[model samples]
Target: MPNDKGRRRRFGSVRKLPSGRFQARYRGPDGLMRTADNTFATQTDADRWLVKQEAKILDGDWTNPDVKIAFGDFAEDWFKDRDYAATTRERNAVVLNRFILPTFSDLPLREITTPQVRRWRTDLIEAGVGAASVAKAYQVLRAILHTAVDDGLIERNPCRIKGAGSVTHTERPFLSVPEVYRLADAVPPHCRALILLAAFCALRFGELAALQRHDIDLEAHTVSVRRAYAETRAEGLIVKAPKSAAGVRTVAFPASLAEELAHHLAEYADAGRTGLVFVGARGGVMRRNNFRRIWLRALAATGLGDVHFHDLRHTGNTLAATGGASTRELMHRMGHSSVRAALIYQHLVNGRDHVIADYVDGQIRKVKRPPHGPSGT
Candidate 1:
């Protein structure tokens, strides 16, 4: 039991107040005495708090409460530190301005709590935000808060909702080999090779759109993916390297495609080593929106409605799996850095176990029958 006397301590002091409470005061880095806002019921509580404050000061983690930065300001700085692609930067900016800033822009970084984060996420969902959109916004928020934690702006990240950043997508449609060819024939004559290459080579639309005449070696039967294009509202068309290091690989094509690709290049593709291989009717970049009508018409004609253009690549991967391609081979052919997408093809091929089972049944039948005589043979 401390009396009405005060005891001097290193960097601070603890005193028993006349109201029968213990008060703690410390000299801040600004050379001013900062007293605890409320009194502690026990002298031990007051001493513990003062010791913690001193430890923070000694460790250079003490932040001036009055000069704390706003969440928006810190987040802006965090974004500027990274060199993001144009499309990615535009997407992050949209989420920040549309979802994050409205809720916690003015709040100081230190003031945000886990409950506040949970409430904000709930509010966004209640306001009719799509699950995917909410997930994206939450991801951006978590990234910002994660950097805040690293910078010592806060002790912990408030974005702690498990699985809050993941968006669940419905199964994508898959196309059959005959369906792929039907759709290819239904499209315009100039785009026949484009559809074939997309389905057979598993090349993404961006990779196909950015292909140059020099990238394809008909003699070598390979296509080199050196660059890719991204269409963004702000930049219109931004050309960059492949999304991953593995994406910049040379993929092989069937000998049958060599003639078709040659014909397309000679007749339709722009002339020059750097000439665009797949362009619009008027020799412009093939924008998806501009060509959507043509694609839709082809789908309607082929009776393959609601199939996305990307499903061509999926179909190609499925065929590759059926052809006995290994996981590493699929990864290389599809230009994927991770095995996650490659594993999907593995799962798809599991359906072919019925063929193995049928082969086993045939073997069993052969054993059950009597040995064939020379005359029967």
Candidate 2:
């Protein structure tokens, strides 16, 4: 043989480095020579590492050690690979740009450690970022890293901070029946029905904005939630499906609202059956910025003190619970996709139990009362 000393081995080779540590190199199945990402202190340890790489290749699980995709590039591709709603995409974009990508953009996916994620969250909170914003940012970061793990780009997710993605929901004040009527009376004449329906029917603002005359059945006192409106920065206001399958429901309203509905239809509503039931003063789509001014004024006039429009839905759910709506019934009425949310309203039913007990006592007295004639048995 002609100088076999300088030739490389068939599977792998180990050599003592000038630093006295051993390095391993192997010929990959891709026909390219590759080196271990780490150095070993002895030749035996280096041989063991190369043997593991050979085992990975033979088992069809070998991933390129040198695949150094940057986090921002992978995250962009991950976001694009999915078909998300316009609103969801917009929110994710905001979270990524404002919180996540700035910290981890240049770091390679495999190099992101759990310590770095914890530090990032701590920095955001220390910088006075709101808890909700931090939670959303953490959730998005965890999701992106989760996908990276699934793609075999990283061994484990670095987002191991327990419950960091979830935020505690602080209970907000809801309108009472009188408060609801007062707020309704305070708003503009055209929006009175909107307030009532939002409070009683538990309609979302988007659902109310997307309503057409045909969506309401005055005779049946039902509102069909077929579609909803979402304002995205990328596409302005767009009509899309409801947020969930449970949202695409037809909910019955109290027959008492019939007069209010009829009055709104006759006065300020668009003419045709297909025409919008509620519109801005310009007779176009209802934009939040345009409507919020009037809403705040009405809140001030009624002394509601900055009650969000969604609080009306909360009030409605509470009312339904007090009216003896079961968990399933509450879920259906509120279009809640999960029992967990419906259960929160169900907890509000505790105070109604006193009324239930009094009613039962009256029924028992009616049954146990003496005979009508002469106190006969």
Which numbered prediction scores highest in TM-score against the true structure? 1
TM-score of each: 0.82, 0.80
Report the lDDT tens digits of candidate 2 across residue range 129-221: 999999999999999999988887887899999989999988977777668877877888888889988887778999999999999998866
Deviation in Å, model 1, residue 367 alpha carbon = 34
- Quote the lDDT for 136 in model 1: 97
Candidate 2 has a TM-score of 0.80
Among all windows of 10 consecutive residues in model 2, the one with the lowest summed lDDT is 368-377
Cα lDDT for residue 61, model 2? 73
Worst 10 residues of 1 by lDDT: 368-377
> Which ranges in model 1 have alpha carbons more than 4 Å from their true place?
1-8, 11-24, 35-48, 337-377
